[model samples]
Target: MHIRDPIHGAIEITPGERRLIDSRAMQRLRHIKQLGFAELAFPGATHSRYAHALGAMAVATRVFDAALREAPLAPAERGRMRQAVRVAVLFHDLGHPPLSHTTELALPPLGALALPEWLVDDPGRQASHEDMTLKLILDSELASVLERSLSDCALTATDLASLLTGRTPPSGAPFVAGGVDYGPVLRQIVSSELDADRMDYLLRDSLFTGVNYGKFDLDWIVQNLCHVVREESAWLALQRRAIFAFEDFLLSRYHMFMSVYFHRTSIGYEAMLRRWFEESSDAYRLPADPQAYLGCDDVELWSALRGSASEWARRIVERRAYKVVYEEHPKDPHQAPAVESALRAAGLPVIVRRSKGEVSKYFGARRGIFVRTERDVVPVESYTPLFERYAEAAVLVRIYVPPEVREEARTVVARVLS
Candidate 1:
């Protein structure tokens, strides 16, 4: 199947891949929007996760093929490695909750997933969307399909799961060849800070949102990808010359978070959705069963909201979302309380959301992508000043109020800001 994506042009899917894509688990992504409430802010940002999945797979394939050129892997292992990364990236977002990360607050406890000890160490904590994806791949019918598709390469769902989860693959098999482990580098292509997801999403989100903040030199970055070995484990590395493009990619994601992802309108709606999910927890619960998850898309969630009687649900379903009365920057003080207090005193309902945008969570401990110079290899963070400049996570604190009381909320905000 040839998928014509606006971001990657033509994305080709093989017969084996088609079976996975056609599975009910994958089709659920079609009803789930990529940006969630972001569509309310950017009208054009109504793309589905299904589209993003295909785009990420396409990007990962290119990265693997390019970086593999520098790796010394046996011919037999090369095909398996390539297929593993492709499957890993393609299903990475399969477990995302309805409306992306918003409704994750409504998920069951980690123990509910029944994941193996090797996969998740803490089953007592709240489950994440990724946990759901992992179960879907490991235990659901999708797992059967995944295993059968990978039968040719002798790869099981657990092996592919290991690639995404960064765990041991059926006996700590690290794609070893001649005593060198190439698993790290291969997994990094689908994940890591410079993975295929970021590569495609930056450009895809930018195009769909009608913003240039997420646009980066992807072609240049991909062409300059160089594989390197660190402590005997292969790692993803960038050519010294393409370091500028890598910096731009980091900045692009940062800018998108501030300008698009963290837009106040979407934040306000998300806050309301969170409230509704909490209030209606018993009435609308997320199932632990993977097969039941096929019906748990945004459509079902929206329908529940539309049919509910709760004030939060009514506002979200009626498109009468709360308006952002004030925003606090990363360096600003915490004044959301004062505004929210004054609004409550004035008989107003308010939602205070603190959205944290990390500059690069992966670059903090010198474990990020490597900058391969002609002489030596260093952590990308140490190689670029951009990391230090963006070291502090960008914080956006927003105070939201009903549209009818927006003016009154602004009055409260002005007093708080003063």
Candidate 2:
């Protein structure tokens, strides 16, 4: 099956992948918007997760093909590794609930989700969309498809799940029970800082939103990717010549966050959605069971919101989103309370949300993105000053108010901040 994607052009799906995509769980993604409420701001951003999964799979194939040329693997091992990476990227987002991250924020705290025992210690790192994706792949009908399709390649659902979750096997240890050691490089392709997921989403989101901020030299970066043994483990590295392309990719991500992802209007609608979820009665509760959760999608959520009596829901349904009274990057932590007090004193309903600039933090501190130079491999940060500068910046803060009270709220915020 060939899919003509707006961002990636023609993406070919194998018969096995087509079967998986035809499954009910995968088809549900068609109704779940990639950007959730972002469409409220970028009208063109109504693309679905289904498209992204295909794009990521296609990009992963291209990247893995490039890296395979330099990898020291037998033909059979190379073929198995290629299939594993493809399956991992294709189903990585299967577990995302309706509206993507917006609903994730509304879900119960980490403790409430059914997390594996290993992740219990770090409450902050508990069950997430990745966890959900792993669960679905392991327990759903898709698992049957993967096991049957990959039987010839000697890969299993667990292998695909681990790859999709980016699980790093212990250094110098074989990844599979039989001593196969393709985990590190495959995981990096699926989940690293410059993985196929980010590469696809950056271009895909930019194309759908009608914005040029996220555009980058994808071909240059992909063609230059090389797999190498680093610290006793295989890691994805870039040819030194592609350093400029890598920098451009990072800047493209940062600019996209500022211009599209964190646009004031988009944030305002997301805030309204969260408020609706919090204030609504129990009738709209999300399912805790992984299987039940699969039944939820954007259409279901929109119907519930449209039928609700909550003012927040009404505002969202009518597109009467709240106005951004004030928004600033590098938020002042100490001054927030004063601004809130001033807004309240002026009789304005206020909501303040702090959105961390994750693209910077993820690439800056992740310790990935190595540059393979003539002398030796080095972390990109060692040579790029921009990484450190952006990593240290504070999270962005946006102050919101009802459209009618926006002017008053803005005045109060300015007076208090001054």
Candidate 3:
């Protein structure tokens, strides 16, 4: 099947892949907006995770083809690795809750989900959408469908799940070509700081949100893919020439968070949603059952909010989100706390949220990735100061108050600013 994505253009999928995309878990993404409440701020930012996954898969294919253009791996092994990386990227967000991260608080403890022992880190920790996704693919009926769909590729759901988890398969690595363990490189393509997921979303979200902050030269970066062998394992690497383009990709995501992802209006509604979940905990709880979880999406959450009496829920349903009284950029002198306190003293409902962004946290590029220079292979951090420059997480603190107290809140903010 050919899908003409706005961001990636023509994305082609095999018949089995099409069937999997049409599965219950995949279809659920179609109803869940990628930016959630951000759509309320950027009317055009109503893309879906379904589309993002397909785009990421397509990206993985492109990155794989380019990265291995002259590698020593045989064609058959390359084919397997490509499918593994592509599908792994395709399923990475299978577990995101409706409205994206807005309702993750409603998820049960990690132990509650029937996941494989190898998949769980700490059962006591609250479950995330990623955990839910792991459960669906490993233990749920989706596993059967996944196996059936990929029978031709001879890859099991376990193989794909291991790729997502970044773990070795039961007995050995998933891909072995000429004594090289190719599993780590495959996992990196799906995850690492420069993974296809980030590659797809930055462009997808930027286009849908009508912002240029997230735009970067993805083709240039992918075209420069290279791998370095360390201790018998192949790790994802970049050619020395495209280091600047890679930095631009990191900047694109960072800028998007500063400008679009953390827009006060969107953050206020997301905070309000969290407040509603806190105040009305019994009103909604995400199911641990993978099948039941499929029923949880943005539409269902919105419906629950519409029928609830919680003040926060009412605000969200009525499109009366709290107003941002003050915002503190990551490096700006702190001011949100004082404004937040004064708003509360004035008998106003307050929501304080801190949106965090970082450039190179995900794959531990400092240790895992190497930049292959003409003379030698060196750690990415040492190759450039970009890592140290963006090591500090950008924290955007937005303080909001009930819209009814807009004037009162503005007065407090003005006094504080003055």
Q: Give each model a TM-score.
A: 0.96, 0.90, 0.95
Q: Per-residue lDDT of 91-202 in model 3, one digit per residue for the tens? A: 8999999899878899999999967777878999999988888888887778888888888877888888788887765566777788888788888888887889889999
Candidate 2 worst ten-residue window by lDDT: 169-178
In what order do the candidates fall by TM-score, top score first?
1, 3, 2
Among residues 3 or more apart in sequence or in different chains, the pairs in candidate 3 whose N, CA or C atoms overlap within 3 Å are none
The Cα RMSD in angstroms, rounded to one decimal, for candidate 2 relative to the true structure is 3.0
Any idea how many clashes model 2 has? Answer: 0
Q: Write the per-residue lDDT of candidate 1 for residues 224-283, one digit (tens) a residue.
A: 998887778888889989989988898899889889999998888888887877776434
Which is the leading candidate under lDDT?
1
Stretches of candidate 2 exceeding 4 Å from the true structure = 108-126, 168-180, 331-337, 363-367, 410-418
- Local distance difference test, candidate 1: 0.85
Off by over 4 Å in 3: 363-366
- lDDT of all predictions: 0.85, 0.78, 0.84
Off by over 4 Å in 1: 281-283, 331-334
